[model samples]
Target: MRHATQLARISSILSATLPPELAGHVWFAGCDGPSAVILTDSPNWVVLIRFQQAQLLEALSHILEVPTCTQIIVRVVPEGLPNGYLTQR
Candidate 1:
């Protein structure tokens, strides 16, 4: 299993590259041992991401790949979270 430190590290790195709007939209992202997951909320899309081992990094390499993931999950979050901007890249 992945430690909290590893998850924190990955989350930090992921947060840095996010667009200003997407800053707070992404709740968390990190490696859970050899796997990883990312949580993102948007007005139009509430996305949950999961990957095996290094695949997360590989998918992240192509920004669109992340959003286009076949395993992505989406659902409404009641009142919703803060509004973060995700510039149309």
Candidate 2:
């Protein structure tokens, strides 16, 4: 339940921080400890996200009022992807 709350808060942060065009395309999937996972449809979004990672993390840290958010895991999901999706390193 705590994790759910945390992710929801993070989602809010993402929604506000992301650009107008990129806001709704990302979904907050879940998290393990301090690392949060997000889902998006394309690799281009992932690249854009990577470029904006620092700002997102800063926003999250500011909103959460702690340094709990240390890493972001972005998973690209496509219609024809394999049963098990692979996240970029």
- Please, what are the lDDT tens digits per residue for candidate 1 over residues 2-86? 4444444445555556555554545434334433345555444332233231344554545433533333332334464323322
Writing each residue's lDDT as its tens digit, candidate 2 over 13-81 gives: 677789977876666666568876677778778987777778777876776678776888888876633
Best by lDDT: 2
TM-score of each: 0.39, 0.66
Per-residue lDDT of 21 in model 1: 53
Worst 10 residues of 2 by lDDT: 80-89
Scored against the true structure, residue 3 in model 2 reaches a CA lDDT of: 56
The window of 10 residues in a row where model 1 has the poorest summed lDDT is 80-89
